[model samples]
Target: PGAVLDLSKVIQSFPGVLPKPSFGYAIAMRGGAPNENRYFIDGISIPTVSHFSIQGASGGAVSLVNLDHIQGMDLITGAFPTEVDDALSGVLLLEGRNGRKDRWGLRATQGGTDYGITFEGPIGENTTAVVS
Candidate 1:
């Protein structure tokens, strides 16, 4: 898996993040612990951003988020902001894509497990609905 895309490889490219040889995609950042880093989508915290091997929790190979679904990424390091006081090393914030509002849409995700179908449309005049 050394041929991952630039977006998936960007997190380890930061100045203080060190890439380990045997930890899959795991990184030790800012001379801190490997599990010290945190990940968030929108404003909700997730267990990890890396793809799992299905039966175990040891991740770090490839990321779970598709590059096509990302709008932006914020990698915060140092300065210990008061809002996010849990992390000791850094934080990775990911903004997911918001599907088109002009019309209904369907997206398909394949691999790792069974096929996943997502349907999105407007539930009301100002509210959008999505089901997966």
Candidate 2:
């Protein structure tokens, strides 16, 4: 992969994040179990959101969501809101970008075993559509 964006690469390098190093990449954060953590996108919970999900808690080798479409993320390690009651370890929240209405935009990226293109623009005066 060339110029690929991987969340696991970043997480694996973090302090106190122990590595699994078996097939897939997984991390034990601050001595907590990997399964204790929770990951979310746009308020929706998913079974697995990574290409190497069975291996690493670092978000696998490839993220299921497109990096270019992410607007922001909320990572809470402790004392999360009551609504996020499932995790005693941590929360990784993601927000996706809304399509731009003013003008068309396109982006592409390739890395490791992943590559993709994204397109965004107005579908109508009051709506926008984003495709990846």
Candidate 3:
């Protein structure tokens, strides 16, 4: 409904995930508290995925991860494997994409509360880089 495409809003559309009754984007999964969930990017644990997150909480008004850079996402609710630690409610895994090696590219985006520019290209013989 707005210019900003929030990740939290998208997550709210999933079944068994409910948005917090109050402000911000904190979510409860399978009747569990929001803080019981965990977030990860490229197998690395991330404390919070939202901007202006609370001291021990995991959500805010906006997401810190850019959707354009994300290649895939996995949402696991309950019965987590050994690799996912401290997840009593759910786990959100974000997989990032590598930059294009064939050529350089640039993109600019304007949102409701922020603006961003992304650049991607080859950094080395076989390595690529993406900066936003």
Candidate 4:
């Protein structure tokens, strides 16, 4: 498990990306400001990726996305893509995993500062649900 369960922490390992100075959970890509970057989840744009985010800025003490549910992530810096607009720095795309279909499952997590329970199960023949 990561020091912090926030998914954003994963990006810090990537080259050319650095955590913004004096701002928790905020990232600066290729010297661009934090707000210049954009974040997307499954093709949908979200205002902020971190919890307790500041108004008119992005970054906080933690991330709102649960790492357990993430399937994959793509970080794009420089060379803007047509699908992602209005970004001057970078773009992060987060993909969530589908709930289990064969059977129901439950998972509980306890961290130094937080705890959570996740429930996933089949809703119907072809539908599944995941609640955290």
Return the TM-score for each candidate structure: 0.71, 0.78, 0.88, 0.88
Off by more than 4 A, model 3: 1-3
lDDT (10s digit) by residue, model 2, range 1-132: 232565555445656556666555565666787767777878887644467666335446566666777788776777887888887666778788899989889989875657778999998799998887
- Tens digits of lDDT, candidate 1, 1-132: 232433336677778877655545666668776578777888888766666422223236666666545679888878755767898877888887666677898887654422456677776677776654
Clashing pairs in 2: 1-111, 1-112, 25-56, 26-56, 26-57
CA displacement after TM-score superposition, residue 98 of candidate 3 (Å): 0.9
* lDDT by residue (tens digit), candidate 4, 1-132: 565565667787789888875556788888888888898988999877878766556677776777677789989998878988799988988897899999999988766445667889999899998887
Off by over 4 Å in 4: none
Displacement of residue 13 (Cα, Å) in model 3 is 1.1
Runs in model 1 deviating more than 4 A are 1-8, 53-58, 107-120, 129-132
Q: Rate the local accuracy (lDDT) of all candidates.
A: 0.65, 0.69, 0.80, 0.80
| Model 1 residue pairs with clashes | 25-60
Q: After superposition, how far is residue 117 of candidate 3 from its true place, in Å?
A: 2.4
Q: Which ten residues in a row have the lowest lDDT in candidate 4?
A: 1-10
Which prediction has more favorable TM-score, 1 or 4?
4
Sort order, TM-score high to low: 3, 4, 2, 1
